[model samples]
Target: MSTSLYDADYEALRALLKILRVNAKLTQVQLASAMRVGQSYVSKIERGESFVDVLLFAKWCEACGISPGVALDGLRDQKRPGRAR
Candidate 1:
């Protein structure tokens, strides 16, 4: 499938990720520090300006104290109404 910032499901995933980070009580700066990158990296990812590959995603989940499997399930359950799968 084609991935883009405009894709509904992809956008939902990004939003969910941001929500997850917030729920974990980590600001972008904190999360970025945990991930050993600049805050701009986190901001860019949240803004969908960067594509998060699986390895990075797993690291991100780890930094947030989240299980990647659980996150994947959440991602799987994300489906916007009227959007083609």
Candidate 2:
């Protein structure tokens, strides 16, 4: 796929998680602890190996000191109803 198309395929929620983690200078363990989850869970999220529900997403944003609106905006723009990329 072209870069643009690939960007569309990229899971925005996962990207947001990673960006938040990096911006906060927190390791997976640190973020996991702050979010009350296992380090492996954070790792899995970074690797795009799992999907997080809205509630968990909100919790993660809060832990990173980010507004849920900021975290969710990218995802909302990319996703479409009844469409699979």
Against the true structure, whose TM-score is highest?
A: 1
Across 19-48, the per-residue lDDT of candidate 2 in tens digits comes to: 888998888889899989999988887787
Residue 39, candidate 1: alpha-carbon lDDT: 97
Q: Scored by CA lDDT, what does every candidate get?
A: 0.85, 0.76
lDDT tens digits, residue span 20-39, model 1:
89999999999999989899
Candidate 1 runs further than 4 Å off:
80-85
Ten-residue region with minimum lDDT total, candidate 1 = 76-85
lDDT of 2: 0.76
- Per-residue lDDT value at 42 in model 1: 91
Cα lDDT, model 2, residue 27: 86
